[model samples]
Target: MKKSAAYWIWTICLAPLIFLAVVWQKLPGRVPMHYNINGEADRYGSKNELLVLIGILFAVNIGTYLLLSNIHRIDPKKKYTAENLPVMKRFAFIITFFMTALSCFIIHTTLHAGSGFNGKFVVALIGLMIAALGNYMYNIKPNYFAGFRLPWTLESEENWKYTHRLAGRIWFVGGLVLTVLAFFLSEKAGFNVLMIITAIIVVVPTVYSYRFYKQNLNK
Candidate 1:
């Protein structure tokens, strides 16, 4: 991993922890820790519990970073490791950043439990992350740990390339639509849209890959 990327990852991973430490005294003894699908706080717990949750999230971020950074070393295929290293590192940073931002968002919400859940913001953030992944999805080589990883995509390089190329465009557009809808629709409507789009993005690529494989087999 590049020194700069590693530095940012650490900084991001620790941001929520630092924030919680600073605001520990200000938080109420009981805080809302979970929200329902309708974006209402349905669970409450002690502030101490929030600390434990954040700590666990931070550890998960570190674990994820380490895994992504060394994924190529563990995979049997070594031919594309050097070429894909940068993409992997960039993705690591992106994941770290997203997780950090999400942690911080949760902390902020915890502090203002009365504000209700900001489903739109959460959905928008998720959409943005998906868009980012889609933007780089085309660059990902066939690997066990990432990308589509379907049997068809893994067995044929052509299938992998074409499937991802089509997937990238579909995901990018779908992500943007989700982001836009998050703000305009009610919480329930937005949730429904998110699910539908998620299904489309995942299923389309899988079905396309299978059909592409069959066509190639017939050829």
Candidate 2:
């Protein structure tokens, strides 16, 4: 593994260990998140088992990063930077971090330990992370494989360029704010903020870009 990737891999491994170790014993036996979209509860083990599973997720994340890094190394010509992916690979790790925490929350509730959960609130947290992920993906590439992939964006390179230029800044800043808030806001209020922010990010650029492209096309 390249030194950079190796460092991140190790960093991921230790992230949960350091953050949750102190509170590992304090984790509620059952964490009840009201919204069960998939109806899948992560209630399959003792607290000890749950901690092990978290470790496994951490390990898997590092391994995946390693593999991708190797791919980059093999094809040194291939660069995974903001221009190519708009900082997507880097943002992906952040998304994964939030997702892991969300999953742990689910497990914490399902195990039926202590503390009542605010379902809407927890759902909002997940939504914020998801919105951030979507924003990053859109910024990463104008290609269909990455971002919003609107008809205009896909149809015209110019449109793609313009849309991403605007989208990148919007999403990056929006995501940063949301991520920070994720640390501070209560579940319900936090999610409400995330939902509103997500809608604005999606709707504004899409409408603006389409109109902008049309005007240019006519001109």
Q: Write down the lDDT of every candidate, Cα atoms only.
A: 0.89, 0.60
What TM-score does candidate 2 get on C-alpha atoms?
0.57
Q: Write the per-residue lDDT of candidate 1 for residues 124-201, one digit (tens) a residue.
A: 888888888888888888888888899999999899999999898988889898999899998888888999999999
What C-alpha lDDT, on a 0 to 100 scale, does residue 50 get in candidate 2?
A: 64
* Cand. 2 Cα-lDDT: 0.60
Clashing pairs in 1: none
Clashes of 1: 0
**Ten contiguous residues with the weakest lDDT in model 2:** 30-39
Q: What is the lDDT of residue 102 in candidate 2?
A: 59
Please give each candidate's TM-score. Answer: 0.97, 0.57
Clashes of each: 0, 14
- Give the per-residue lDDT of model 2 (tens digit) for 167-209: 7667667766776675576656666777887887788789978
lDDT of 1: 0.89
Q: What's the lDDT for residue 55 in model 2?
A: 71
